[model samples]
Target: MKLLLILTALVAALAMPTSAMAAAFVVDDPVDGPGVGDPTDCDGGAPPGNCSLRDAIAAANASPEAANSITFQITALSLTAGPLLLTKPNTVIGQERNTTITWAAGAGPALTLEPTLTGTGSTLRRLVFVRTGGGAAGDPILRIQADGTFFDRGQLRNGPGDGAEVTSVAPATTDNVTFAGSTITGNARNGVRGATGARNLAITNTIFFGNGLKPISLEGAANAGAGAPVGLRVGPRQPDGSLPLSGTATTGGTIELYRGNPFSSASPTLGDSFGVGAGAFSRVPPFALAPGEPLATTLTTGGAGTSEFVLVSVPDDIVSPGLTSVRAINTTQLRMRLSEPIDPATVQAGNFSVEMASRPRAIRSVSVDGGGTEILITTAGGWLEGEAGYLQIGAPGSFADAAGNASLVAGRVRVAAGPGDFTPPRLSNVSVTPKKFCPSGVKRCRGPRGTKVTFTTNEEGRLELAAFKGRKQVGNRSFTKDKAGTYTIKFSGKLRAGRLSAGRYKLRFTMEDEVGNISPAATRTIRALGRKRR
Candidate 1:
């Protein structure tokens, strides 16, 4: 009959959901207290059990659920009894946010998730663990042995040992641990250690500062074949000090660094202790790191510093040359602005080729501007008005930064014929006056004179004026438009018609648009009438 009852209970337990079977054990004592602390009957005991953290853990283990949670009612508590051994899959949460766990000297870990508890998921959150005295060399404030354990929103500080250690006892078992929104600092050893058989560890939104040793340490077997491959993902560090975000490895492992805004992963320089083996470190895309992106690299040997793989806030080295602005220099010439300087050698006719619905304009030549950041492409023929086409830089590595980092995969940009200013600038209100002078009125001098030509342009462009005596050319002057789109040309002394024998001279005025289109020349006749002495 007892056997039948036991079987019936097992069936009922199996039928219940994991949550239904789970129990919540509460610690009511601010000061360490001792009692049986049976989670199911703590309140039933005479005077009610004290229910210390130690008792709560014990009760959680005794529960039959696969997953249990232990909550504390006290705001502050001290653990004089040493490490609380957790032997089951449990979550220990502080009911009152920011509860403090003070560990006395000689106390082991504040909490040790036993390795013997297979297939358990453990979590520690919203609690502060402060060690008052020194313990063993390798003792950690929190030791995790179960797979899929999480440490969230907690602070582990001032410990004489590591802040946390994650490892698996079973040779074949691998534990995955994650730390989020937590602070691990002031520890004598590494803030977090991943020993043998620990893999897939991730730290996100956490801060590790003032730790005596490296912030993170990965220990693997001396023989590469002896241990499992470990992987670590670290988020960007907060601005506290200049302490570099780094990691140390006793064996082979992989580190993935996530970049913040404006930061990128550069080619890693290996440290002295790092070994070069079959698989050396390599970067993907061979380009600059983008903002808020993660870069993964493998380390085949142990090393002390982050030189194995480090991030730098470098000027964008591998960014593909971007076309910042485009303008039609003329009917057959196009100007393109680049975001950064490009190797002039890479600016080839084939590199700036175009394709369109109609026969694309063949690139006659590609040249870089003096600034080295702009490209001028002269086409074989004028582009049709409103023509649509695609402009692309050739394959990868065709263009590179000064640092020699290859550009990103080239991409095509849609190009459309810009509005062509067919209407040429008008040279209206044109006038040319010659100034005559003499030392004395009686002595009339037939020397040089000052000449001024003023005109207005309906549009912006260059203005050119030429003088001709019959078919023989005399002189010419050119003026560029100012910001207000106005032009004036002046000639003085010998620059003007020097000692001209009063005669009929023809003046020609023409306006050339920015696109090299010339307007009809306007002609004006002026007779250089020599002045007489008064």
Candidate 2:
């Protein structure tokens, strides 16, 4: 019964329908709480303003919509109201990177997402959850009892407990979990510890900084235990297919890309602890610590009651290169910096392209400077000074810092005008490429014609697009800039009433600059033809 429910919730939860309406609750107060809170009773919560994180979450829980959102107006909130429990999926979005949600010393985890009939359902964006007091326990900052969740561009730090790292215990196995563009620091134990249950997880563009223990935990109960059959048999693959207890034994865990995460331990038993040294970490059996290497910090050996420590680690550059920063150097060129130096031989001008407002820009050439970490590219006309766009590095296999690993985010990356880019973004060269949107029913076209809109911008900004068919609104999509430039946003022609149908629709583009400047509205028209039944 437990297993079935787990699978059902995980699968259903992953299919978040785009058309489902969402209820939004905005936080007006930063006070943690006055205990008993109810979302539906919006005006009754104590502290009078009627809106708090606890209250907002309560309101979202009662919402029947496919998705609900809780946004904060204030910068910080104390969990004084009590434990935060989410029964339904909700998005807790913060005002900015520094927006914080804090918990008292022994308050337990900052937030708990325990769904009754679903996964630990929620997406937390741009918020920081801090565990204020200490006393190393294994509690995680975010207690993910289930799966099917996303923590994007957020931070989780300062916790002491088994849950020290996000964990899952209810459903023995949870799936479809992702933590992207985020940071986890100053935890007592593992940065991310997986449950014995299926911990199907993915990490992208995440950094683990100054973690008390391993940045990641891969040992199952069997291996993590220090009892007899104690340590994982470590060694290299011998000529006869046998692995001898020595250097380079695949302990069988790959934390492939760990970006600039530094860890240090001061315990002899843990001198050669998990994630002892950063670079790119992978777990293999027994690689001895250097003769004079420090020990007794965070142990990875045989746990406690065990001895003989090994400092198994991989150096930087073993993982693929990633963008650390992007900036425009005057109007003449732009530089995309990488996490590590690359082999100059992989350089190719054709591999890089620029885009503004959702459209691609031309690239005359691209080259890797002597530093090996900077990729300087130029367009025929040089970069537009106020342009807000992004650089599209070559696709997978096009470039590699190390021999085989390709750079991540080769997709579209926003361009940032480094020196002074405060100008309100402007739109130009706007295009509705299919200026006509076609659904599957349109037989006259070579294929079921899908459609997209493209436009260029003078500075980095956000684009909110509203599509209207006849007198009614059909679709709405927001295009967010990575830096600032051109973009080609795909338009799903689905009508507000149902799927796409024969009609003339107008796409309204509203662009907003980084510094709160809104641009003049731009509109494009497209016609959709009915499908030809087979």
Candidate 3:
């Protein structure tokens, strides 16, 4: 009975269908004969009957009941017809370190996986497809239709559609797809294509080279010729003239990175904090400290253990301790230099913190000066100065000491100074006299789009203008100063004639010193004109 079972298995294997082997997983290795049949040995017993790549794929996919089989691994012998096809549900993984599949010149593609997916949950990973032969600019090396999770850490080249495309113009579900660490080069079309309601697709650390279109493109739900509907749509009537919550779909792009602060989330901490010599302390204004400038600055102990001084900035990613310079400037003031120059519009004077290793030695007061370069730090009440401890700074992901630590907020500064002056800029009597379009006591004004407004500050500093219909900033304007701090800019960009919508608009002006500090939002009202033509 056992012999009969073995003979039966052999006969069945010999009688297996040939077309199925051809359309299944086909390999063209010279050693592995280009046929569909189980070899008696791994490499056909060191002869011409070695199992080909295509036969290996067929074996993986063939099940007594399965219409098609799943491919676990394949070792391509060469680039001639090296890529595998997928018309059914399964995964193709390259197993060896140098194992890669290449498509032949004038070949249809490296891999062509059409739709008709069972739409079941399956994961594909650890595979690479290379296009060795040049072809039409728009010819894709790999095309994936319908839906399934496909992950690639591979190389693609020499065509318009070199990478991969997951598109279904027909209304079908293709959700939750992700791509990472892939390089697509010399292509005419985008590397990845998303269509219909394909939401929550994430792409990361993928470099696109020489693609005519955007590296990543989404057709959006509404834009899909026949896909699922998405979002709230009011106007463009559909075929039935019924307003479905689907007019023109759109998709937004966001980057998620495993290395560095590419997402602009948290700032990079401790970026190259090389402590300079004390002599870098003294510098001419427009402080360009020449390299190797010798000066002496010391971190002294008022009493006991060494106290650590740390600095941190606000709105994470602004500056980190490593990227900031904490110079011991006199006993009363410490100058903090930011990693990059900050925009004056986004700065608020009291929004930073300086800390000491000893909580007791934490900063007591912070006085920011103009030019946004220097900060005056005074010891807090709880600060217990020691001889040996060091000081560190921290602020939400903004800045930190050599060792990453959070800096606490102790107290507000008595006054904020300009970058140009240790004394904070002050305004005694400055006025916004409504000129042509303004009416007395009405507060708001309605005038032409390019109406110019003048602001006068008692001291020299930068001025920021903000115009809003309510809380939304419709128009914002800024002007830099040499020594005379005054501004006259048209509230044109933010204030549109059509944006008035028949109501009063709020106007506020803010003043900032060179040191990252800003004054309060000075409030005023301006009546906005309607959208009517003159």
Candidate 4:
């Protein structure tokens, strides 16, 4: 029976069509390159540092020619990125509203997801597409020619053309496109339009506002005979925001909509501990990550032979920590309140992004108060009182609860700046101690305290540290510096992953004054030696 089962599995595997084996590409650089590196290796070629989105996509598109069904683990990406093409299925997955794809006037559509030879579509998550300078653009934000394209948790906003529309006006065989949990607003033309020959286009859990002409127009233009959309499915607004097919009827011509997006509910084990006190925290941020290290090594001294209250995350616990509120304490500083205790070491620029008027603000440093309930962030530029903006957190699945359960979903909060001094604190002579870190079992990379964080501030404020290994935020540690001078504190950042790959990490620091005025930012780089030696 076991042999028969094995043979059945083998037959199923043999019957599967030959597509490109799965691959992950970490796009570290912000610049565009053809990605001359080997498709299988993705080493940034003989000259490294040029392998970014284009390069990764180029390599990913070329992967079907290779032998091994390589599941490449890409670990990093750019934070200001652009118009590109995807020939493969579901090539890039960005956090909703957390990842922005901008297109220049001359560049084609911000992105084009072309279907495969067999006519299968792609799925993209949590991405925002827009035009530069907010003027008339020729192409739609996204041009989907595939048959079953599914895009969730994205925003098609502020464009000169349609927010999301068909690839062609004459309909070159595009249909079965679905858009969910997205915002289509402030565009010059229709929010979502369909051209002739399109069929079964659907959108749900979406918002259509301030768009020109019509919110949704499915018919083909007058001149293009029979170019109108064959059918349009507008689903009902989900109460909890789950994407269940509501079986709504199709309306052929044009439809105006002011529908709203859905919000996810809490997991069964999830509960909020609002207004938590600082004394509840028993251990440093890094030690709490439930990486399954020996409890003896990580067990904090709470009681009876090393604390039974081990401040470690339970592996695989599905608690979704949520951001309850985000408000600026001052022009340069913002504080976030959370439902669960977040691991401080994982709070960094790589995990959070700030956007004002569709542009990102440079993050200097982030501070998590001792209890992990409140997060303080210091951004580079200051804003006036009541300036509108947003904060996108945990986009790369970085921040976690005390039980080590990573926040798989990204969340965003609308924020308005508070009144305070616009000038940020001055920072200088920042440094990280000579130490390296790898995962728990890996002996090749080891150094005491992981790495020490030392810096000087001009005024009384807090010392902040945010560490990132490529685009992945590894860890962060923050402490209050009442009266500032030169101070050397041990950085408790875990270079720990399920073991780590040998690579460089960016160590960022900032000084926030008592009023939350933050310095621009100081950066240092440290390397983590995984299995490979430098």
Model 3 lDDT at residue 435: 27
lDDT of 3 at 353: 49
For model 2, the stretches where C-alpha displacement exceeds 4 angstroms are 1-19, 41-48, 90-92, 95-97, 116-121, 134-136, 162-166, 169-172, 219-261, 265-534
Per-residue lDDT of candidate 3, residues 304-348 (tens digit): 101111111111121122234453333334555443222333333
Ranking by TM-score: 1, 2, 3, 4
What's the residue-level lDDT of 197 in candidate 2? Answer: 44
Model 4 segments more than 4 A misplaced: 1-20, 33-49, 65-83, 90-92, 95-97, 104-106, 133-136, 168-172, 221-534
Error of 1 at 144 (Å): 3.2
Residue-level lDDT of model 4, residues 1-534, one tens digit each, is 999999999999887767534555654544542333334335434255545556566676676632211121333332133456667654545532355555444455666777665535566766676666433464577777776777787788777778777654343556667776677776777777766544666654455567765655656431132122212222111222221111111212221121121111111111111111212121122222222221111111111011011112222333445667677766566777666567787677677888754567888988886246567888875566657689886563456665444555466778766545556778888877675655344555545435566777877888766666544455565689888688887654443233334678776777767655567767788776555466
What is candidate 2's lDDT per residue for 400-479, written digit by digit as tens? 65333455455767777534543446877778766555675456644436777788887677886766654334456677
Q: Which sections of candidate 3 miss by over 4 Å? A: 1-84, 91-93, 96-98, 117-124, 169-186, 197-212, 222-255, 258-534
Top candidate, metric lDDT: 1
User: Global lDDT of each model?
Assistant: 0.59, 0.57, 0.42, 0.54
The TM-score of predicted model 1 comes to 0.47
**Could you tell me which residue pairs clash in candidate 4?**
96-126, 196-227, 196-228, 220-228, 302-307, 313-403, 313-404, 314-403, 345-475, 345-476
lDDT of 2: 0.57
TM-score of each model, in listed order: 0.47, 0.40, 0.38, 0.36
